[model samples]
Target: MNQPTKKVLSLFSGCGGMDLGFEGGFSVHKANLNPIANFGWIEGPTDSEQVLLKKNRFETVFANDINPDAQTAWTHFFKKSFGYSPTTFRLESVVDIVKRHKAGENILPKNVDVVTGGFPCQDFSLSGKRNGLNSHKDHTGKIIGDEDIPSIETRGQLYCWMKEVIEICQPKVFVAENVKGLVNLGDVKDIIQKDFSATSNDGYLVVSPQVLAAWKFGIPQNRERVIFIGFKRSALTPEALEALSMEDIPKEFDPYPKATHTKPVKKDVPEELSETKLSDILSDLPEPDGVTDLSHRHYSKAKFMGKHCQGQGEISLNGISPTIRAEHHGNIEFRRLNAHNGGKNIKELQAGKPQRRLSLRECARIQTFPDDFEFVIPATGKTRKRWDLSPSQGYKVIGNAVPPFLAYHIARNLEEKWNLFFK
Candidate 1:
């Protein structure tokens, strides 16, 4: 008998990277350039996204995000590129969605095989001033600090909605991803774990959180996120999560995919990691952006005033790319590659003219976004136009997304091993 595809309820699904990874029907854009150690090309050089002939193994029943821009970008990718419209993606705040669902006005499904999301993390991030839950300035107009996260208002409270969704949908499996800072941010981790385990139904058996680095998992960027997984307390069905025996739930979730590609950091260990470099992934592409006059970083008033941060540092072609950020387009983004000289680092040769910021395509590549996976935003989202971008929607969507390739590896592990939890 043919097995039914698993359905996922995705929340805070900005730009659908996790959704696309779980729905693994598309081919990656392979970079024609060579790899550092013959791992693989950055992305495939195809104009159109390749589709899997067989039906996808997993389906997204619902995807929600508060931002209209993200919805627009997602709609363009699916509707314009794939010729299939996904009403599965709805633009609604998770808080409102849960309230409406509880009130019997929402259309979300009552039962789902899995639930997943990278909840709003600005509250618990080490960066962004560690605002925690207090998003708004106080009556004194001072921003709240780490001590105030649990008691603050604003986007920080949205994470509790994740627990609420678990309460309502009562999925068999649930996974949540967040910034690494969540583990150290006061009592945020403990609070969230307790809330997540306290689902309205029978609650769940939560696993110890683990930090997964994107670079360790074939992604070029050095991005790290803490992952949380939970299984329902009691067996619900024969094919449901009950497939995993209660005696072995923790042991099943204990081990995860180890790093396949890594840089040689110590003398004892051989380089198992691919050590995918920025030049290897992005060198084949055409220039996406440039500033003729402001190309080179010079010793000047503006350079001094800009007070460039870590992301602004010039990246070497030989190393992993920096983490991609959402808001800082020109500031934190990487410098453009000089593909002509055997894909030389822009800083190495001191390119005669000037260095430019990475284009949207390059940023997408760093985030493991397939080249064919198009971005249609208010900024330069088209193929022909790359430079002179005042990106409002495009950058945020790309930066905020979980790399599809990274998510794919995680989903693939879940697909094969979820049964073993019972075995």
Candidate 2:
């Protein structure tokens, strides 16, 4: 009478964000902000929110990440929720996993139903050096990085490893997320998709990739990432399969998972009512305490770690945040009060400080991580080296995560549409 849970194997699963969405056992915190200038988190996910993620029908059987701090954060949340450690293996490289399988080892089970990952994006990031190898027909018409792909030195070739896993495990559906820059990075997108669709025995339908904005999918931030959602030809209905080419699939699945929220520019549009803002998410979060020590644990004291040099900067307390970045640490946006305490700015409030940095929990909330998801970064510590990071790694892991809330909609859409194949 009930369907069995579909198994998932995740790669590059930093902190289990994607896997958590697939498992679907947590609920996020929510609240209403009124009177405009509120900077408090009136609500956070309840301690028991994990009990509420059962509205979906999938489970993560295996997950892996290179960062141990990410593993710490990953294990910390699941252990707290499930009362046992999850299957997120650490210290294992995707290259090694693929090699082991090719060398006649069973790194992953052969019966995965769905596979998902947000592979490393640094090489393909337009903001970065864009050092990955690509066709010379790019905007600049020159291959910036001639480094051989499949070379472990650069992360660009890691997609090859991802493809290898998909080829061997042969899941019915596979979804990959990456920066928008990838689609336009000359031959990088073409090479990866061609490799993905090349498998004859268990090939994908190679649906046209769509770049999705997180805000459109209910996330408060204006993050945009390209999504590749492909259905196995044998797993779709006859009519859906009739239009299953790289070009045709987009027509059939047009507006795949239509936006539930929007931010219209016109002040009169009805959709404007649904636009989420930074105030919507963090207004109720506790404001940062004024502390100037960059070494301090809590984001109490904001730091201009590299505001001028790295292009990382601050965010106004009353506005939506820019893209939450991985390496910025506190270099990125920190909320500052407009006027308070006899009209003193955040700088004067904290003994001549300029602004206040957000705490780790607040950052997680910004990443749409449920309050109870539990980033392992300590509230205060002399040194967080035990977790393989300088305490600031919490922000890195949170920023690098796939935002489980967004992944939830993607996974839920697939489960509803493709579970018929599994059943």
Score every model by TM-score.
0.77, 0.80
Task: List ranges where model 2 is wrong by over 4 Å.
Answer: 31-54, 83-88, 134-154, 246-255, 271-273, 288-297, 300-302, 305-307, 337-354, 377-390, 419-423
Off by over 4 Å in 1: 29-56, 80-86, 137-153, 236-255, 266-272, 289-311, 336-353, 377-390
The digit string of per-residue lDDT tens for model 2 on 101-122 reads: 8898866876898888787787
- Candidate maximizing lDDT: 1
Question: Candidate 1's residue-wise lDDT over 1-423, tens digit each?
Answer: 665778899999888888887776555534311134324322333453222212236777788897776786676666654454668788877766877778988578866888899988776777777756555543223455666544322576666778888888888788898998888888878887777877778878776667899877767787899888887766334433543334444544442454566666767654444466777665665443352221121111112113235444555667777778786444545453345423346454574534456556667778877656555333444566443322545677788898887777677667766665532
lDDT at position 121, candidate 2: 83
Clashes of 1: 12
Name the weakest run of 10 consecutive residues (lDDT summed) in model 2.
32-41
Candidate 2 TM-score versus the reference:
0.80
What lDDT would each prediction earn against the true structure? 0.65, 0.64
